[model samples]
Target: MAYPTLRDWLFSVKTFAAAMLALYIGLAFELPRPYWAMATVYIVSNPFVGATRSKALYRALGTALGAAAAVLLVPPFVESPYLFSVIVALWTGTLLYLAVSDRTARSYVFMLAAYTMPIIALPSVMNPAGVFDLAISRTEEITLGIVCASIVGSSLFPSRLAPTIIERTDAWFRDAAFYATETLSGRIAGSAISGARQRLASTINGLELLLSQLAYDHTRPDVLARAHELRGRMQLLLPIMSSLADPLIALYNSGRQSWPEGLEALLADVIKWFNEPLPAVSEGYHPDASADALRERIAAMRPPAAALASWDGALLSNALWRMKQVVDVWQDCRSLRIIITREEGSWRPHFRHWRLGGTQRFYDRGIMLFATVSAGLAVVLACSLWISSGWNDGASAVTLAAVACCFFAALDEPAPMVFRFFLATGISVLVAGVYLFAVLPHVHDFPMLVILFAAPFILVGTLIPRPQFNMATVLVAVNTATFISIQDAYDANFLTFMNANLAGLAGLLYAYLWTRVTRPFGAELAASRLLRSSWADVALTASTLPIEDPRNLAARMLDRLMQLIPRLAATDDHRHPSIESFRDLRIGFNALDLRRLTGKLGGEAPAAIAHVLDGVRTYYESCVNRRKREPVPESLMRSIDAAVARVISQGLANAAAPTATSPTSARQLRDALHALIGLRLSLFPATLTSPTPPEPETAA
Candidate 1:
């Protein structure tokens, strides 16, 4: 085990202090369950100030909402225990579905609300008239604990998430740069690239939680905007970088001797540019002279009109075009990072032409719904047993089952995690049992209680900051606090303690078994669903007539790719799916770009482009229907080549007679040519032969 750092020790000290403060206050206020106040401290405490505060707010709101729900519902259904259990189960499930769907820190509110109803209401079912008071008291105690945690966490040696975000952003950019450089220089290994891409996607996806916490970080609006802008550019960069691999690999496979003169020089220069460091944020952000220079070199190296009609020329042109995009996006990322990290600045965005997608994510509703329902059923099962057996402490069992269910509803396989919870809670019961029977009864006063609690609580709090130990330590700490049942005065009963703790164990065991039985498929189902969703999206994009922004399509595909990565890793089906997702992302971009470019191309070009798109739609639709990858038809290849030939020929014709073509018309023709070339490359990387160009005289 790694030794704890000073920061971990500090966090532990602060957390222990907060817990004690909450306990002392609860005792002074004469709360019914003073230990509950102490337990709440651990539940909401985080190493970072902003995260702690955010959780505190969510926990407070969820607690109030849940308390209100219990106050209103428990009285009406108290006389009908079976019907009440059913009602509670539905409430938990419905809220859990929303919580799981959100996929954000905000989901905590719904999750807490889901389980909190059972925690408060089920215990008061026998005393219907007292439910309201019970709810109020529980809310007050929990809110007090939250307030104590927030104050202690934020006010003492507060750790801000903003700096961590900036640090992570730097690391992400460096890794992406390394991947891009390796790919461009033709030295990247397949496995290396795969792992790099997965890490980049995971980092980008993981930032959502930290970014969500930024609002509570006292971050400036401009800084927040810069952070988000940097994220969007990073998303934009992934597919472009991945797309560059195909054309470059194709060119490399054709042999170094076939490379155009100065092509390697140009590639070296671009790689050098990526390796160069930018000016620091304190120096104030300036334009990246290197990115501009690299783009100019790339533009100068664009194939001549005659060469554009050849297979090698198109491949070279597409690769250079994508390289230029990577440079532009990288420069934008640098500017945003500098701005975000700057201590103070008045900054203007350097890149605003692209309309990036919003925060809408791809949630597997079917799987999430199934998981939520399973969680609800676990609650129902626990309740039925409790009601049937007339167990006096059965309320704790039902409450814990609901808590266990809500804790990991968002995971692909929550069975293992639930099992961990069982073990942690079991350990906690033993520890709490010892303290209740052997230790606490010997303590007569608050300071003495604090002295006794210090060693264990502080030790466990230190482990909370380390991710591997976080969940287990949290369960142990919180459950131990709850189990000890510290009231306004000393009251320790051996039988009462065992009954409640055993019931909790029973609830957790049921949850574990229920999850294992219901979710045996694990990540495979979710991974397949994400893949199918992307296929469906591609099919829809290809068939739709109205122009869609390629950026939005890129955003959705990239986001889907991010979500799919971890699941793919878990299933050990990584390589093939990663390739397909990247290919689909590139295809979606090319398809959308083609649709937009269609409005600019005239004559046979639009007809040819429509043919290619129709084929794309058909191919993807077949994949979706078969629930497997369908082989691309030779007809699609023919159509893509036809579209490329038409666009290139028209573009050449326009260039040959400058007087006949407006600047706008020439630019449009060029864009269409590039899009068609990209589509051809994406669909047929192996096909090297280009169609015959039209005769110059016939073009004129």
Candidate 2:
């Protein structure tokens, strides 16, 4: 590895100190195993100080919870090892499902909880009386390690997440701005949009981790609201950029699209601002107000009604309209930059203003349910084989298999990961044996023990941030420390150690077999279920639920959109889910607008409009319950036309009043009409194609 920075060296030093402290504490207290505490120091240490504390707390809780379960479970089934094994397996499986569902540090608690009982109980099957004492010892050692790691990380010039968040956001904005320039410059390649989508999505994901750490930081809440604002604004940009690109692409294909006058100038301004050297956080930044001027110019210069429908006029209209939108989005970015710099202290309303709702990872219940059953069954199988063979080390196999299954719970293909872990475990055993018998005899003091172990731990801290072999490094370090089993009085027996290690290998071998057999299904069921879920949201949108805010609702559905993109991209099959997923995105957005538009109705909307919504709701519900593609009734189609006319007249009548609320009415009507148009396209795309209607919905 390349030489680490000063921060990396500091982290390594802190982790090493914590591990030695944990060992000393355990030895001084005469705990059964000081090594467990020592090893946990490495396991819980995180570069971010707050993350270290968070993980430490969760690990402690998980250990205690697991120990409590072992205490309750081990004694009753001692006589019948088979029944006990099955019960334990089921417990691990159930908890494993919950563990993988949350893709955060919190998952550590559930994973530890799932395995803690078996770790204590399995070793004492023949001597069940010792189970409670073993569980207590295990829990205490683990908790001691957690406490040591947390204290060391928090005290030793701890790394702050706030500065990292700022640096990361700046880099992300630069990439996005470059992409926007390429898109507007008409140099966009066929793959560019998808690549941009993935990059932006990944950035959003990374930001969320930093956002979660904000509570642990001393940063003012008003400055943090910019992140929330940026997320919402960024989400809007992708769809708008995509929508704008489509018409431009069509015009380019026909050799009609050209950059509108001053469009490149407006785009250049945004690019330059984003690419500028970032100022210190205290510096004020006034956003370039060029967007409003460009928008007004475009509005004033729009073509007359007749020429707009012609091919040449259509090309210019699409280019100018989308350019204005791009400018608007860039302006929003500059506004967010100003807030992030904390330039305006008077905006106290922005403090604590960011609320993250509906940001959970989308785990299909089917996957979780499938994993829970497989984990339990794999354990039961391992146990039955051991019990029938009358193996003294059979409990080892049962516990190892159960723990391994839960450990790889989040992986789609567990067999490969299990094999990697198996390799790491064997390497750990060799290292542990070397230290147990070869080095420890001469190391008579705690300080000498720390010196002997310091190099190995420093290596772990060095390798922790690596992407490729980090997991293996972790397992080797953890397994070696755990297998050494340091106590006040050291006992190193070759036969007993070899037997335990071999049993663990056997358990992992069978686990790999089980994982290969019960591999996660990648075909239709998950895709179908997710598509149906989006339809259910549409049905909800049609219900009496208030639609005052669609951001939360949209955010939740957008998560499923991300899920669908990857699944569809993985397959080469015909009738891909991507088409349906794209349709669902449009449907979800439209449903929100439809709901909002309907909410503002004062019994003035045409009665036929109500009937049209009812029919659409029925169709959506049908899609959810069964994958039926029931087309909208021709009568409902006609009513949509009538509703469009009603909305247009109302918008026009309100146009004369021209208050702040007038623009809102205009926007609502436009959104409602856009939803109706999208509904028409989705329901009967091939058969009922219509020319693009004018803005006031004057087309039949």
Best-performing candidate as measured by lDDT: 1
- Clash number for candidate 2: 0
Give lDDT tens digits, candidate 2, residues 356-385.
244444567877778778988898888789
Q: Cα lDDT of all candidates, in order?
A: 0.82, 0.68
Q: What's the lDDT for residue 267 in model 2?
A: 50
Give model 2's TM-score versus the native structure.
0.81
lDDT of 1: 0.82
The list of candidate 2 runs beyond 4 A from truth reads 1-3, 185-189, 217-233, 247-278, 287-361, 522-532, 535-552, 565-583, 598-667, 674-699
Question: Which pairs, if any, clash in model 2?
Answer: none
